[model samples]
Target: MKTSGNRVWLTYVLSDSDVPNALTLCFSLRRVLTSRRLAVIVSPKVSRVSREALSYGFDFVFTLDEERNTAGLENEDFVKLFALTLQGFEKCVMLSPNMLVVKNCDELLDKEEDVQQTFVFAENGDSSILRLRPSLQVFNCLLKQLAKRNGTGVDSILKKWLSDQTSQLTFIDDKYNQHLHEKASFLREEKNIAIVNLKNKTPHELDYVGEMVLQLWKSIYDKSVLPLLNAVANVRNQLL
Candidate 1:
């Protein structure tokens, strides 16, 4: 496999209900991502309109199928592992859809030069990246570690694995995966958040969560964030 000479940002959208926020996520990345490729793994449950919208923002949009071996994987979560299978990608970063990219995270792209370690994970959120050279081995390690933990979400498994520190993974700063709770006001004024993770929030909850995300975007991209907010509104309209 050849290198894409850059990293690829990977995310998943399992159903039509998740489309708008996922698109919002990719759109924000399009605004600030300087040199990384972007892709999304969609499932059969996604509607045509949502799929078409994804094409606009992602470089490659993979749809799940029997051949993809995604059967029985809750929310098509297993498909994230397939990102390691992509040819020509030197590195791949996986993020949950609810996470909003607030600034250029290209700095996170710098891997340890020796390449002995293959995974770099965020401290506070599910976002993680892997340098591809040893990705297959790393992916296998994760699958084995997580296999018996049925009913447990992939994020939790990886979070526990990385949090242990005894693991071979490199840890990225918590600022890259800032959360929007408990101290939302403080996080806003700090203004150093790179990716905003809205984990476990329902769609209706995202309405309020979005306000904080928009505020961050407003600070970084200025007025350009308005059109993106409008785009999200447009998608919400389609849902209704």
Candidate 2:
């Protein structure tokens, strides 16, 4: 579950046979990530190529059962397994395969030594942060009302963006965040992404799809939310 001194203090949750992404992750991060810090959780069906590829870079490997869930995709249990690693490793940083870090990703490793949260997520201006921004609340409310009227499909999009991954928002961060929320609090409202924003006068005023969903989830449920606030933030603080 934990590593003694792996370089990046990172882990990846994935099943076997996803060769293309695996290869991409290995090579993309290899130059920056050392052999000891990188690891992959694999299903038993991991191809020999995957195994060899992993062995070439990762310091740790976890083989898991392929038939362990509602779907082969990772879930809460998968998060827990990786969380266990965090419990032991302290500054552990976990990422999915599709997540690509183009900046100071190496800084996440120092989370423990400095006790600061570090991670960078692409800023999609249309994200749910608009709801919390205070300036956009009126506009967002107006947009939601229009959605209710025309059924054009832009309803509370982020709450349901990744329902499969975040069916509910957990209550763990309350103590740190002053106990302002509860478990199973936020569920993906599940809406259509093709909706347009008549609220915006300009065509370029809209945010992208991720801005609608995952960004919202991050606003509400990202206890470990990416902490890339400014371009100058010590990215090495978060882990590359």
- RMSD (CA, Å), each prediction: 6.0, 18.2
Give model 1's TM-score versus the native structure.
0.69
Q: Residue-wise lDDT of candidate 1 within 107-145, one digit each (tens)? A: 655554425544565544444333233366655667677
Q: How far is candidate 2 from the true structure (C-alpha RMSD, Å)?
A: 18.2
TM-score winner: 1
Tens digit of per-residue lDDT, candidate 2, span 1-240: 545463343434354434334434444455344333665666566554456556544666766543433222234233323233332333444444433222234533433432221221113322211101111333333334433443333323332332333433322111111101111221221131211111112223333432343343334222221222222134434555
lDDT of 2 at 85: 33
lDDT of 2 at 90: 35
**Residue 207, model 2: Cα distance from true site in angstroms:** 14
Model 1 lowest lDDT segment of ten? 125-134
